[model samples]
Target: MTQWLVLAAAIAVEVFATLGLRASEGFRKKAWIAPVVLGYLASFYGLWLTLRLGMPVGIAYGVWTACGVALVAVIARYVFRDPLTWKMIIGIGLIVAGVLTIELAGVVH
Candidate 1:
């Protein structure tokens, strides 16, 4: 349970960092770099913890990235007024399916 919490916090940090980058304006501004770097570091450490728990790297990374992409897109559409078209939805759906498939495949092994 604590591991899951760590993972969730790490992903949230990543998302915030990504959004911060967008605000950073191509990283030209100095302020956003710190948060971006910290977020990535936290995210990696969280994944490391998951790996320590015997989760395969491929499966863990796949699910983490896929879900991150999906959630980021959702947040962007709602928070940033970015358009969420059907095509975008379809792509997110595909990512979700792929992640789930990878996780399930790992379980069967």
Candidate 2:
């Protein structure tokens, strides 16, 4: 339970960092740099905690990346006016499915 919460935090921070990256605009915006860097660092620390708490690396990484990617894409669509076309939506769906498969596979082992 604690591990899952840690993983969730990890994913949230990663999404925050990614959105920060967009805000940074290739680092042209100096103000966004600090938040982006800190968010990424905190995200990595959360991931470490989840692993140390006995979450399998495969599952941890899968869920972290999948959720991060999905959240970032959806949020960016609104916040950054990024495109969220059907093709991209399908790709995101496949990514989610793949992560679920990897997690279930790890559990069976």
Candidate 3:
């Protein structure tokens, strides 16, 4: 339970860090640098903690990346107006579905 919570937090942090990356404007904007770097560091640390708590690496990474990608796409559509076409949405859905399939099937131990 706690491990799952840690994984969830890690995913959210990673998504935030990714958003910071976009806001950084290819690292041209200095204001966003500290936050983006810190956010990534914190997120990776969270992942480590989750793994230490017994969650398998494959499952943890899959969930972390899946949620991060989905959330970033949807949020970027609103925040950055970064073109959220139906095709992209479908692709995101497929990515998430694939990850979930792996998770539910216990494909990685």
Candidate 4:
């Protein structure tokens, strides 16, 4: 349970760092750098802790990235007025399905 919590936190932090990346304007903005860097640092630390807690690397990465991608897409649409086309929505669905498949496989094994 604690490992899953850490993984969730890592995903959230990674999403924030990605948003910070956009706000950084290709690293041109100074103010966004701190959050971007710190968020990434914290995210990786959380990921490391999750792994140390015995989560499989493949499953951890798959779940982390899939959730991050979906969350970022939704958040970016609202925050940056980024387009969320049907194609992107479909892609997110596929990613989610793939993650679920991987997770279920792990459980079955």
lDDT of each: 0.83, 0.95, 0.92, 0.95
Candidate 1 residue spans exceeding 4 A from truth: none
**For model 3, how does the per-residue alpha-carbon lDDT over 37-76 read when each residue is reduced to its tens digit?**
9999999999999999998887899889888889999999
Instruction: Flag clash pairs in model 3.
Output: none
Candidate achieving higher lDDT, 3 or 4: 4
The TM-score of candidate 1 is: 0.88
Give the least accurate 10-residue stretch of model 2, judged by summed lDDT.
61-70
- TM per prediction: 0.88, 0.97, 0.94, 0.97
* Clashing residue pairs in candidate 4 (N, C-alpha, C atoms within 3 angstroms): none
Q: Which stretches of candidate 2 lie over 4 Å from their true place?
A: none
Error of 2 at 3 (Å): 0.3
lDDT of 2 by residue, 1-109 (tens): 9999999999999899999999999999999999999999999999999999999998999899889989999999999999999999999999999999999888898
